[model samples]
Target: MNVKGKTILITGGASGIGLEAAKQFLEIGAKVIITGRNQAKLDVVKKSFPSITAIQSDAGKEEDAQSLFNKVNDLGGIDILYHNAGVGVPPLNLGVPNNNHLKGAIYEMEVNYFGVIRLNNLFMDMLKSRDEAAIIHTTSILSIVPSAIEATYSSSKTALAFYVQSLRKHLQIINSKLKIFELLPPLVDTDMVADRDDKKISPAQLISGLIIGLENDKYTIRIGDSKVIYLLNRLLPKVALNLINPNKYNEKLIN
Candidate 1:
């Protein structure tokens, strides 16, 4: 779990949180390989951190993930699979109609949900092939509760959280040396949440907490408002579920 000398792969690793995490991993002396949909952005990141291996790949594609596995195999092996790629869709104008919802759902599912599935399935084999490894998913606080505004994004993250937990149980059954962790970050000031008028944690702080959690072998890590999720889940289940319900009754939308 030590960051030093470990090789880590982070999907969607070009900008925002992914980029921030990549930068931190480089500082921690880990060999960092980052993937993203945009080659141009990866180029810019390379200019800043030449040590990182930036691969231009769409994590939404299973074939791309398989190719990623090939890349990892060529590297000898990987110590950590940081599933950091994601997207936020369902543009504000359409207001969650069926078509817009479907579009958003596809984008979100492709990147956030199924993308994780393919990445995990492919990298997990490589991880188990090694002596020890770690698998981490970057989800959102919305995964536990509906945040109202990001309908499609929220739903996909919610599904991702469930998937991570399920993966953990399966790993226990197989008795794999690979450890699984989930990061439920609060609202962040990234392109994904640039329009939202909400408080956000800086990317560096989030990365700092994330590194500490992973290195310490913490099973699941939550930062900022996501900590509220753990507290609410433990102390107030009904209120937690109600908070996740989108508050349609109090709001004028569905009421």
Candidate 2:
């Protein structure tokens, strides 16, 4: 997958991992377009990177997804559709049933799982038409081993991980040229996890690993502890679980 000279569209590109990916991709000569829900953030990104295109769109909304597809198609479809947009609801105790629990779970599923499917469906035909096209899905290490504190977030990522595998196989069976890539990142140091005290990797480190994966055609790119956890979960499931949920998370849950 030669990313140089390719056009890439990244969702949730205003900040965090997505923003770092945009910067790295641009450095490698890829034309980058970023979409985000916040107009102010998108405006700031555009000002900072005049060459990068920034579009204001919510990944979780059906109408916004459709509008984004139409706009991207008009601008000439992308060779790579990077699904970096994801959301995690604040941790809540599932043992105590509450209305907010269901609402939060639904929101997480919509943005983290269903939104990836929605955008992929819209861009499938366009991607297929390209000579060398790929879809990158940002799944999480929690998908390999669920987190007790972040149960819904883990479930959403797990669902997406399954979908990415199935979608890749389906594309292969159909003899399609389009490629599906899954990126599993562990405890990234981003605004989304600011309150967490867990060991974290910088967004730059994650994106650098991702770019290397893209260049080498590594369909499943696991970064940092994600690679460690994936192997540990297979060989030592209990140890993997203990590592992910430590004592602090369990204490919080009990209290």
Candidate 3:
């Protein structure tokens, strides 16, 4: 769980939470390598943080995942793989018969859920070979309670949350020393949600909490409203559902 002196590869590191995490991890003495689809953004990150190794790669592409693994292997491999790349299609009226519904769902699944699996499969052996290694999954609070407005996004994160748990148990059964950590973050102040009026925690706050969790070996790291929603969902599912999908969102969904 010690991050110092470890090499961590983070996906979608050009901006938002991933960029913040890269900065914090670098400050803590971890060698940070970040991947993003945009080469220009990667260049900007590389220029700003000369210590970070920025790579242009798309997380959702299988070919890109294999290429990234090869590139990282040539750079001496990584001790941690952080799955932070996720995409959410614009809100669609699923209740109405529309072609875009399935398309949006598939796109979300491809980037947010399947992308993690692809990278994990590519890096599993490399991670297992390390003396101390870990995999971090950035799932969302919506994984606990579905958001009517962002249904596909919620489903994608929920799928990933389940997979992370199962993967952790599987690794444990095999007596693997590699640690699996699931980070459940509430609404974050990032480009992805810039249009939303909902309250959000700064990326710095979220990543700071994540660092503390990593240092202490906390497998399930829930920050901000994520903690509250998780507890409420466990005790009062209806209340938790209402909290996530308020009247305004419900009205939007109906119309």
Candidate 4:
């Protein structure tokens, strides 16, 4: 899709991938409005990118979703619904059960999975009404190749991937102009994974791949090592599992 002159709404736009994408979209001449839960962060982003619109809204809350829809609806609808809001699951500590971790897992589901669904249901009709529109979900390679340390996170993305897959079929059945795109990105150098020294791609690389994918109409855009990870998981599940979660199933732990 042409980024120029499009009305784009991105959730969790305060930082990381969403923030970077919002900046790039603005540079492409799109009317971008970004939503985040932190008003202070939103204000900071707004100041930095005066041309972009920033709003404070929690993607995990139904009322906030409604408010977001109302606001966007007032702006004459959005051309792209970018579901970028999600949280990482806390690192799992083996051989010990932590109640707080369990609670964090549940919260992760609410934000990563349920919130996307709720916002999509609310904004889907608007997108369908547009002549050219797309819904982009920022999932992860973990959806295809699970990591035991990120159990809930993997499950949530897997569920979202399933939903987006099915939604594509339904859209085709109705002959709708709406396009469903899933962005599966590998570990990137973002605030979300700042501490990690894993082989990570830059945000610029991620957005560059995204634009190329969109221009070519790649429905499922796999960025960085995600494509490799996906194929390995499909063709050699055990090897893929061992590579992604070595700590969880180390030789010592398994033996």
| TM-score of candidate 3 versus the correct structure, residues matched by position | 0.98
Q: Model 3: per-residue lDDT, tens digit, 1-255?
A: 789999999999999999999999999999999999999999999999998999899988989988999999999999999999999988877889989989999989999999999999989999999999999999999999999888999999999999999999999999999999999999999998898899899999999999999999999999999999999999999999999988888767777
| lDDT scores in order | 0.83, 0.95, 0.94, 0.87
Q: Cα lDDT for residue 63, model 3?
A: 91
Worst 10 residues of 2 by lDDT: 246-255
Native-vs-model 3 lDDT?
0.94
lDDT over C-alpha atoms for residue 102 of model 4: 76
The runs of at least 3 residues in candidate 2 whose Cα sits more than 4 Å from the true structure, single-residue gaps closed, are: none
Point to the candidate with the largest TM-score: 2
lDDT score of model 1? 0.83
**1 versus 4: better lDDT goes to:** 4
Clash pairs (backbone) in predicted model 1: none
Per-candidate TM-scores read 0.89, 0.99, 0.98, 0.94
For model 2 the local lDDT of residue 17 reads 91
On residues 103-216, what C-alpha lDDT tens digit does candidate 4 reach at each position? 877788899889999999999888898888999998898998887767778888999999999999998999998989999999889887787667899888998898788878
